[model samples]
Target: MSAGETVHLTLDEVRALAKAGLAKTGLSPDHVDAVAETMVSGERDGCASHGIYRLLVAASSVKSGVVVPDAVPELSEPSPALVRVDGKGGFAQLPFRLGAPLLAEKARKFGIAAMGLNNVVHFAALWPEVEELTRQGLVALAVTPSHAWVAPAGGTKPVFGTNPIAFGWPRSSGEPFIFDFATSAVARGEIELHRRAGKPVPDDWGYNADGHATTVAEEVLSGAMRTFGGHKGSALAAMVELLGGPLIGDMTSLQSIEADGGRGGSPIGGEFIIAIDPAGFVGDLLAEYMKHAEVMFETITGQGARLPSQRRYEARKKSLVQGVEIPAALMRDIEKLLEES
Candidate 1:
């Protein structure tokens, strides 16, 4: 495929192609549907890092036994407000799907609840989990760590993952306010995409082996990715490591690869989610607070500052009508997988 050549396709097309490819890789029918839906959601929301670009990687992982295809999530609530989900070494979506509603229910009863999903392979974006809780009328926070790729502040050695975190707050009306971000200067998948396209990244994105910042994507991939805000981002990354890793009795960034004997697939990790019901604290006051927030949001937009998740919401609307555009090369790859299936 030539540069800039793309194929415009609807969400259904993307999902059908992903389902066929994943099914061919031996993922169970239900698992295939779950993963495909999550992937299509990413594409719909303009998250290229977690969209169709990840389908082939997921298929490869399943084929190589890195991700167990038919694994089922196990949920156990040892405490009234605490939930533990075992992903059975499978994809994260299945475990999260089973545990999130339970967490929300617990939060509604007890004011707050937390869930930890362990022994899972999380390859997609984290916003979906928190957004689901918000849709259930709860505020939510979700965090997950990954294999080490990001360097700590002032250090060349990579000690942290590009650990992404997401938060959502339910509104009285309209969609929830949501934000998802990577602690690193850029998401690891974005860097990988640039490398694949033979493009140079920003000089501040990552450092070479000698600890010198470089724009060459290949060098950054071979070396260490930098934290977004130097020490501050490094600190947040550490917080995620503790919350999503050891806090959940799961492996930390460095331990992920070790646990898997360096098989080199998606990050094998844990997911930590917290849900809070506004009615628990101040029911009527919460509605008033949202009104104030809406006024502030209007003011912010009036000043031309975009709210978090605005781009994603707009992208979803556009994608629904105009369809998503996938690179010709990527479409060809998906088509090949479909043909094989």
Candidate 2:
């Protein structure tokens, strides 16, 4: 299978396959629909690593009783502008869908609102949630701590998750200015991809079991993934853990081990989202913000820099105009899974 080979599947075909796969495991149609929608959106947005590639893990987690398919979110109002939700071990998207709109409405009224979500599985990418808030004409910031995969600076052992943080601002153009990234040297999904492909990681991406830097994905997976920028990344990751972790009273990576039968637990990740109404802060802020952003963006591009989301946005546009280019290996895996189903 070549690395860049493309496979074309219509949106309906992809969703149908995901729904059928989930249904075979006794998942409800509603759950299947929601999950399938998220997965398809990820693929359409050119985030295939977090798309159907994760279906097997998600379904297995549900079937193994690690994730409660029908779990309900427990809401608590600690303050007028702050809401906390205990996911009760459900899929992460459940609380995201529920809380995002609530926060948006609250922000519209209060100028700003924040929600803390805990006890949910990994929420895929942060773009989807942020896009929703942007569509509502609000700026949104979402941060989450996942299963511990990256090591702290100067530490050999893994002590923190990849710790993704995302921010989104409304733009008048084709897409919102969305930025999502992991604090780790590389994303866990990328490492997993390398492992699945039997390829080595980059030397700077991780360390060996002996605490020495290495390019071997298996070694890093068995040992510790590196922090992105030494202490800076570690500090950011620590902040994410505190804000997205115990503040909401959810299980950290270490705490999750007790629940997931010791294979790193069920990814009881924690998340925090802040929504801000631009108009509340300043009149016609979107127009002004976009104007300034364009100037700065042009300056940077002129100096040989690209905006944060430009690559993904370009890939998405091309995919929509042409077709999604799924790698050959991923296509083969999808076919194999369909055959098994």
Identify the candidate with maximal TM-score.
1
Candidate 2, 190: how far from true, in Å? 2.7
Candidate 1: stretches off by over 4 Å: 1-3, 197-200
**lDDT against the true structure, each candidate:** 0.87, 0.78
lDDT of 1 by residue, 1-341 (tens): 24598888899988888887888888888788878888898999987767887888898888778898899889999788999999999999888888887898899999999999999998988888888888898989999999887899989878888899899988877778999999999877688788888999999999998899889998887789999887999999999999999988998998986776767888898989989997789877887777887898789889999989999999999998988998899888877876773
Compared with the true structure, the alpha-carbon lDDT of candidate 1 equals 0.87
Report the Cα lDDT for residue 82, model 1: 92
Q: Write the per-residue lDDT of candidate 2 for residues 1-341, one digit (tens) a residue.
A: 34676677766666777777766656656666767778877877777776776677776787677787877777777889888877777887777776776787789989999998888887478888888889988999988887777889988788888888899988776678889999998877688789889998889888888999988888998789988888999999998888787877776755554456665444776788899998886766657866887787679879988778888788777766665666668767666655674
Deviation (Å) of 326 in candidate 2: 3.6
Taking all chains together, the TM-score of candidate 2 against the true structure is 0.89
The residue-level lDDT of candidate 2 at 10 comes to 66
Report the C-alpha displacement of residue 125, candidate 1, in angstroms.
Answer: 0.4
TM-score of each: 0.94, 0.89
